[model samples]
Target: MTLLKAKSILSKDFRIGRASDRLFGSFVEHMGSVVYNGIYEPDHEAADEDGFRKDVLELVRELKLSVVRYPGGNFSSGYNWEDGVGPKERRPVKLDLAWRQVEPNSFGLDEFMRWTGKVGADAIMTVNLGTRGIDEARNLLEYCNFPGGSQYSDLRRSHGVRDPYKIKTWCLGNELDGEWQIARKTADEYGRLACETAKAMKWVDPDIELVAVGSSARHMPTFPEWDRTVLMHTYEHVEQLSLHHYIGKRENDTPTFLAMPLEMEQQIKDVIATCDYVQSVKRSSKRMKLSFDEWNVWREPDVPYTPWQTGCPYDWVKFHMEDALVFGSALLSILRHADRIDIACQSLLVNTIPMILTNKGGAAWRNPTFYPFLHASRYGRGEVLRLETESPKYDTKLYTDVAKVDSVAVWNEEKGELTVFAVNRSEESIAYELDIRDFGNVSFAEHLVMNHERLDAVNTADNQGEVRPRAGGTTTLNGGRAESVLPPYSWNVVRFNVQSA
Candidate 1:
């Protein structure tokens, strides 16, 4: 009977909250082929009129991304925002130590803004809190958002941008604690600098929002202390505290790797406590949120580093099938924490550990992770509903046997539908029956599954259709529950027409 069974959840009210309120966004850095060929492939057939790849743009648009963090991951630590502002031909070339690549200075601030505009998203710009300090940050703010007057604003106008970008979201720094990070600073140093910088940047544009650096990851030895100290210094000055965490499937065990999102839940919980603690200590009622700026299932098997080698830092790293499954779990985890995680960007947008990868002079394809992101971003809006599932488990050395079922339900108040994204990590398929008590009656539309036989299957530019999310089957129901078979190692999205249900 395929071990199918029904589990009645008596008080099964949907854990309804805004998923978009939690948000889905991505970052794009200057390293690797992310530039030059990734997002800016001029010679490709898919290239748009502005030189941005049309194929990649369509994929990004499909991801339903609300925000796009610009021009830096680690790149911001060393970037000087002014170099690429004026006439393109007059810009000066410089060395970008973050990625060990030469800065052509062709695709600068203006280009990035235009790209964000084309992508139908808002820009989340990062300030160089490293080598360049407050004055540089303020100048960039005035240049992008200031209307006129002063040298920088006038230079922006002379550059033909009559209007200021006025980007309101700003990141104070990117991973300031890492030794590899350019101009890394001590917690105290970063704290003082952040406070002063936030204060000054606000002076330039008070409407702008600021984020302070949280620990690079939870395991960082300085962790809670770093967060406490930074918040102590800058809590009152900033609106959000940024956290960056990345997971990997290095174990080669699908179940354990899929368990990562649940683990991330714990880490996010800790960060939340830390923030509340700081808020309590400072005796401030104003709540602060989290920005998970860098995240995703990155498959960088190994790092072969030759200090400042004469080559790009990221050469040809791309994501595969299983990686995307893990990515779905990560997005599910983000939904679970929708209330506190105010801003989240999928590590990157194009190339350099991106959600979308492109090849110059050829077509580009969506990474295996793209479908999950696309499905959820397009439908994971409105109120997020909490789901409860029970299944058999498997044990691994790192983490014990985990539940085979994981799910996040989104109730789109705007569209009046419910999308239940479930990741069945079990090796064997399981037919499950669900009853959503909140929706007394509704119709199930589709059950799309992102699955394939080989764990390593990938999408290439030539055979882009080799892997993708295809239309799923669903019951034309007039009932109170939803039923579906969640395939092994797959992510499933069950869409329900629950407008008034």
Candidate 2:
């Protein structure tokens, strides 16, 4: 097979920005088994004192998540924070109209905070804005962040939580623009409500950062217009705007599927443009950041369950190797825009299209998507180095000049390390070259690759290692230059120790 060629140059002076730790965030919603058998199962043999599954916790810890958005997605729109607090027995059981499931109220506010503490992640709490508005939003903020003296704070103390949870990040609401959302609102309505709710919540706890709801998906008919209107209304009050998107395979086209990140990258740039436009309109110096709080490769499951069933099994997708490649490329897209995207959460952390899956009373296992997220979360930190690349290109039905090699680099000054993340989208191996400049002497560490002969290969509880990453790829470094042969249809991570001459 003839080798395709790709070259990239990286220098210390060319930096986008320091990657935010919160860029490695993941989300956990009260949908499906994600809350019940997924993370909190009392009867499991590996269950901890708090009823959280220790085996699952072990996997979550490995991801090194910076923040875990709690009790939401669409769930928060209809959620009543009061329903999930105090004693588990006394808490009210309600019909969750979001996913058409019954919420037992067994695990609520306090439980999620404790779970985040156990996993060593900060909480990005979402308040109810659909069914309830500013009052309920402020009340939940007080319940979580206030140090007594008020009704909600005293109520929290009465529940045996003496000190406040002090959650620093707050999402005003979830996708309120989607018609599928429980009390979905128009852009004007959501913006006014989000703005006022942000005001009251900050009044309750002045230290919290607020994220206003932007367009739920890029293809929404109201897209950039919705974002613009919402920002125009709430820009002064909020710190960040929220965006959610999910990509999936299209008609068995592997090349087009791998090129999906082009869409993602474009969407990020468009949203940033809208935010900046809003800033220019207001003539304000406050530049708004973004929270890509919900993102993943979602393929709706064929699995079925009766309506109103508590802890119902739903949308448990076993991701394949091809999915992981696209997923890792999506991470690279996010890393490339680290200056604007301050926070990102892979939606539904367990069971419902998650990285890790658990068998009700049995074992916990990883999906093929787990390893890419693991590698990115573990090594894709520090300053993002902008790379200039030249590679063989192909045109897909939706994209033109799509690079056969998708890649990004991160330079960790403190650790004296440089990490390169690359993906080979073509079915033929590529001869890759890296020209390092101004970083002085650097030594190659290891090349980790994830490639499978079968595009549809998956991992299950019984066979967890069926499609994991391994140390492979032929790579060598000399005189500030590196060369490697990237495998066909693979996800690669290369590391190097940097020293100044």
Candidate 3:
């Protein structure tokens, strides 16, 4: 009889307790339905008394989003804050060059703040470092943070918001390294502009936090140089050095593909080192952190950009299952380094590669990738525990000798629960023993699993329930340990309870 060798994982090492848990922070932008129908569909049946969709709000709360980046991805670079404020009736209609849509100006600045308040999440505002600069940024600070008698603050008062928005975290720009970015600037030009703009903004609201743009991607030809140049020039001017990284499933191979997340793990280390290097060069005591502003799974080959002649409003691309798995991997990486990355936005919150998407007006449903995002945000807080696991390597086109299962566990100290988030990207079903050694006096709780029949499965307006989360199977609890069954191509979160002995 042939004997099957168990996928043995020895739980023996205790490395660094945690890196960071900023995976809680996600992003939202005003492109496509993200603003129009994604969150603010006036025609939705589930909209609340304030015209905000109750279904979406409930979902966001369920996801337990900590921070939602607002206003723009590329859209902010060209946005006019004044145009969006004041009486809606008197608001001017303008062209949205970034998304190629008509900016009705009805749902601008104040409307977003109102929605943020409704969702019960902190706001991360990105300034227009691209088209507009210092003056507009200062006015925005006044409008959102300053007290009475000021022009912008008075405008905020006239608009019915008596209290200031006081959004503490702010981003300087979105993907300024890419030439495709609206009003793209050279590194030198951007550095000077950001320096000036940040100085002026700090003068307005000294307490506010600022993020300077980093490289769009390390793979870009002008990478480390762009990052160094920008940081060298703007690090002292801001609190956080922004880093934007995205991963996509271009290759059909799952093994190497799942390794993308760990690649990002290395990415953050490099970014931290970069921040330190620049800080050392300046001999500055102020330690700058990272704001991973924009990140997600975007493969240009998968979703071919619609020609502008077709009037494709702002690169609107829906997400897929494999893409979501890659996203899951990305979250694990971010959680692993939460210490240096205090503030991070998930690029966008809706429709355009959005974590949550809505269709049929106000009726929202979870995307296949949404479950990983939901689980990570919901359970991934407190000090992250460095879990030790061993999975056989799978060779693929993108990465060599990548582990089949990618997982990260977060221990919510307050709740006394150890949440293990695992992803099995192997082609065959496998089970692994989860050894909770040394630390005992606990029991297994609920295990939530999200898996679909096909890798390409997705949710749509007509059939939103096609790729949702469901139970995988019963979990096994042993002496201070548990055994988990990981189905092929699945993402699962297991909850464990450990009481004081």
Q: If scored against the real structure, what TM-score would every candidate get?
A: 0.94, 0.98, 0.91
lDDT of 1 by residue, 1-501 (tens): 455332323222456456653367888888767777778866778778767787777877777678888777788988988887887788888888887777877888898888888888899999999888898889899898899988889989998899999897999988899888999999999999999999999988899999999999877897878988999999999988988778866666766787776667778888899999999998999888888888877777223433343223363555777778878888888888887888998877776667777655766777788788888777887777666666676677677757677777777756767677877777677666677656665677888887788877888767776667767644334357656777777778888776553
Q: Output the worst ten-in-a-row residue range by lDDT, candidate 1.
A: 4-13
Candidate 2 or 3, higher TM-score? 2
Best by lDDT: 2
- In candidate 1, how many Å is residue 163 off? 0.9
> Which stretches of candidate 1 lie above 4 Å from their native place?
4-16, 301-315, 474-478
Best by TM-score: 2
Tens digits of lDDT, candidate 3, 375-468: 7777777666666677776765656767777777776657777777877777666676677755567688888877777877877767887877
Q: Enumerate clash totals for all models, in the order shown.
A: 6, 0, 8
- Give each model's whole-structure lDDT: 0.78, 0.91, 0.75
